[model samples]
Target: MGESIVITSGKGGVGKTTSTANISVALANFGKKVVAVDGDIGLRNLDIILGLENRIVYNLVDVVKKRCRTKQALIRDKKNENLFLLPASQVDDKSAVTPEDMKELCSELKEEFDFVIIDCPAGIEQGFKNALAGADSAIVITTPEVSPVRDADRVIGLLQHHEIPASLILNRLSVQMVERGDMMSREDVEDILAIKILGLVVEDQEIVNAGNLGTPAVLNQNSPAGQAYLRIAQRILGENVEIPSFEEKKGFLARLLGR
Candidate 1:
């Protein structure tokens, strides 16, 4: 059976949807049949990020309510034939779907796709519970800020309580700030969250531009953020690829200034 992984964060605006979109595309590039599910009902944006917003005829709510077949709700990606998107309902609220409903949907999806990546909503409410219900594993996204890190800790505790295997994806990291003691380092976040690191994404403007253009950054090989997401996908597939160090990317002038 294929694995279902939820990309989630405790607080909002930490790049959960972006991670979902990029990783799904990256996995598709690796020859895997991947489906990206938007679990944030009513506040759904995964479809927009994947550039399938205009193509969504049906959504997760429809599948759960038996209003449409699962296949009918899947929107194929324009860039990758193996990639698909299951968008969330904009009209329905979180109460429209239950945890049981999500579990059944994910179970069905796992049979057909090599990977099911669920883009979970922010907060620890019904949406979060619904997203976690069917996930075999989870990737928690957090920034270097204190609030996001604290929220991530709470999320990790909940994952542990439910016995779900979770990994950390540190997002929007700045190498210069970390070296200058102006921001939290990877070690600092790891020390607090106490989870295995799946990936470290550097701050990049290209990510925003790619989202605005409705293309995942992973499709652009020139983007560092895209390359970082690709590495994360490789690691998820059990590849033995080493994660490149951020320090190594720093300029000589930056290093000298830090010294």
Candidate 2:
């Protein structure tokens, strides 16, 4: 059986969905059969990020309601046959499917793919719970901000409650801001929410451009953020890939805070 991994965030806009798309593509590049699930339901953007939005004829709700088979609902990736997208229904309400629905869906997908990545909706609502229901493991994404970190802590606790192992992905980090003391350093966020770091995605305009263009950042060989995502996928496959630091100096935060 394959693994079912859910990518979630405490709040939106922390690169959760984007990470899901890019990571799925990265795994596919490694010759793994990966399926990216748009667990966001009504507010689906995973399809847009995966650049398969226009091809979504069947969706999560359809499968839950037995309107289509799982294979029929899956849209093949434009670039890689190893990757597919199980899109969420844009017309259906977020509450239309229960946690049980997601559990069954993920269970089914994992049997056919090497990795089933569910891009969860932001926050600690029913949507979040629904996404968490079938996760064999999870990734809680956050920025370096205080609010996002706090929310990540809450999510980590919830994941712990569900007995699911969750690691952290500190996304949209700016090394320059950390050095200049204008932003929270990686240490600052880690101190608040103690968890294993899965990866660190530096802030890159290319990620935004890629999303707008319906291409995964990992597809851009020139992008540093894409390279980081490649390493993240390696780690996921049980490789001891070293995660790089975002700061020029390790103790930048300690010196700034006089700790």
State which candidate has the highest TM-score: 1
Give candidate 2 misplaced runs (Cα > 4 Å): 246-259
> Weakest 10 consecutive residues, lDDT, candidate 2?
245-254
Cα TM-score per model: 0.96, 0.94
lDDT of 2: 0.90
TM-score of 2: 0.94
Clashing pairs in 1: none
Given candidate 1, what's the lDDT at residue 93? Answer: 96
Error of 2 at 128 (Å): 0.8
